[model samples]
Target chain A: MSKQEQLQQLLGELKAALPELKEIIVASSDGLPVAQLGESEIATRLAAMAATAHGLGKRIATTTHLGNLVEIVIRGDQAYFIAYAIGDKGILGLTTPAGSNLGLVRLEAQEYARKLAGIL
Target chain B: MEPLKIVITGPVGAGKSTLIRTLSETEVVDTDAIATEAIGKPTTTVALDHGTLRLDGHLLHLFGTPGQERFDFMWEILAEGALGILLMVRADRPETLPVARNILDFIKSRAPVPYVVGVTHLDQPKVWQPEEVALFLGTPLEHTQGLDPRRPEEAVRPLVRLLELIGTNA
Candidate 1:
């Protein structure tokens, strides 16, 4: 019934749908965690990092005339940190184990991020 | 529990970075670039600034925004889900009051969060006192304070007030 409760339910469903998702964070584009399923400390940093990352990405894109950034993906040895731009502002930070189906993960991530964006 | 997110904002040269540096035990990570255009300082924050502090077993995340209006977008982004805002302004530069007001209005527009008008430059004489600033900004005197951003004890006062507000609001 409350906004916080609804946020939790939304994130829970998304994680359930995406088994590859190790954790997910719905944060403001500026990088404040709204509702997250992960370590509290890391999630807090993830919000700030994701926001600053978005700022850098936007600056780079504008300077290079790259138009606009859609998503930013960072690949590590055993994990992936993929962030989707939810409309003009807001981001969905997804941590998935390596070797997950990239296509499906991205598609679902985008959809879920859009829904989360509306919720915010 | 997530650390209470707080945003520090004001006009150029308002001591945002210094306030965070003084308060945060961790080394503050900031994206400061050499100013292409003339401003008081050679270096200006381009992206955002971040630092962390632990109080009463709770983590607090501090995010500072670029003072220049060009980066007003960050103001909106950084203000999201914030427990409150600390609108830092210099005591000597009353001219920047308008900019501080704009930033405060912008954040208030997004979320009805509690905020304080932090008037820096307590060491400087002939500057507006916190009470005067509160009057100028149309905020209550209780919501404004004079502080030295370089002093950790003074820097943390606004945050302590914000935390109290969050507790009461919760």
Candidate 2:
């Protein structure tokens, strides 16, 4: 299968795994939306937010003498958004209901990020 | 003894750099300088801000991540081996709560570390109470406190308390 196809499949897998997720988006580190799943409008906003978050993560990496940011998760009362940097140019953004299995979500997100990194 | 690694972070213009410079007597690494040198432009730090201090014979390494959401990658790396976190917020910037929440989320995901909220610009009129700031950030009550980042002696006390909290929690 093509890389794009594989990425789509992966997104499908994530949605299936975490049915409570509100949105998932793939975005460039520059804040551009590349691909997405879930509510269209929310995905667009999330893509933008993910890009901004990724940029901030890069700054944090450079300032601390640590290497780079792998992932960042934001939790609210009813929602959770997790962004993971995939390689240098891309990020995987996931939004799930609050109180979901964070460990599982993180694990899947990391796995997909790695897989997508190989493709992108 | 080895220096304790501490990360100070918050929204833009929140006085993170000023706080570290005032509280620590040692020379700061000035990551912004490095960033400028690297990018060859007068760019703000796209990464971390660094400094060092000595207190009671122990060295404390201080790092400050950029407050903007675009440079968040630096937070993960800076967080490693961190003894504690000092979350700085400006009294005038109510928007800092979202940024603070994001930082807290990042920190909680890694390890449970002690953190103190330093409310900067408290000397300014119309400052929010520490309790109110805590509520805004969704942090536990009593975890937030007002601070004058320009005052080194005053800033160091809260920092020391943060370190103590880390020690106790760890």
Top candidate (lDDT):
1
lDDT of 2 by residue, B111-162 (tens): 4678888887777787787788888877776667788878877678667778
Best by TM-score: 1
Model 1 regions lying over 4 Å from their true place:
A1-120
Candidate 2 interface CA RMSD, Å: 7.1
TM-score of 1: 0.59
**lDDT agreement with native, every candidate:** 0.81, 0.74
Q: Pick the candidate with the highest DockQ.
A: 2
Model 1, span A1-120: residue lDDT tens: 887788788888888888768778876654557779867778877765666566667666765789987888889999999988766556788899999989999888888888877776
lDDT tens string, model 1, B25-141? 787777665454566776667688888998766799999998877567788888889888899999988888988899889888997888888899867777888888899899988
DockQ in order: 0.06, 0.06
Clashing residue pairs in candidate 1 are A30-B77
- Share of true Cα-Cα contacts across chains kept by each model: 0.08, 0.08
Runs of candidate 2 exceeding 4 Å displacement: A1-120, B33-43
Model 1 CAPRI quality: incorrect
